[model samples]
Target: MKPEDIQIGKLVRKTETSSPLVECFDMKTNTCPIYMCCGLKGALSQAVGAFYGALDRYTLEDVITSENRAMLQHILLRSKLQPAAGDQDEVPDLMQGVP
Candidate 1:
């Protein structure tokens, strides 16, 4: 399917996980002192889950729309880190009208 044909808003799914950073931390070496009573880990996990859920709603086309493209360009120009001259040409010409 064409990128533009997909609906950006429909891809997101909301779900919660009971364990947050438990999988990341090693029990033997990186064990948290308050592992048993730590609410922060679960909360952090839920926050990350929510972030991904929100991000899932956008398609490539939705993110690269004309308005968004312009906004991105504007932000990039305003930022201190400018793209290299050679790298500028590597950017996809998504602004071009597709047949």
Candidate 2:
């Protein structure tokens, strides 16, 4: 599908994306003792609304522009052409710093 027609928020939701940065924001999983009067919950709720609002404003086309598309395509093609540095099942060296 064309990037221009993709609604980011809808795409994310369709994939069941989990924005789990703030654990307390999830009503089903929330176990905070101060559920009734927590300022963080109010702030996080607003943040989540703002997040989706921003997502709704743009399509995938907004992120991958005409100029960047060529570069991205080149990189994608190059990656496909090259053999992997190590075992196919193993993590790449670039991410060795990660746990």
Provide the RMSD of all predictions against the true structure, rounded to 1 decimal: 9.6, 10.9
Over 11-37, each residue of candidate 2 has an lDDT whose tens digit, in order, gives 554444444657676778888788788
TM-score of each: 0.40, 0.54
Candidate 2 clashing pairs, residues 3+ apart or interchain? none
**Model 2 ranges off by over 4 Å:** 70-99
Judge candidate 1 at residue 70 and give its lDDT: 70
Question: Candidate 2 at residue 34, lDDT?
Answer: 89
Clashes of 2: 0
Best by TM-score: 2
lDDT scores in order? 0.51, 0.60
Model 2 Cα shift for residue 5 (angstroms)? 1.2
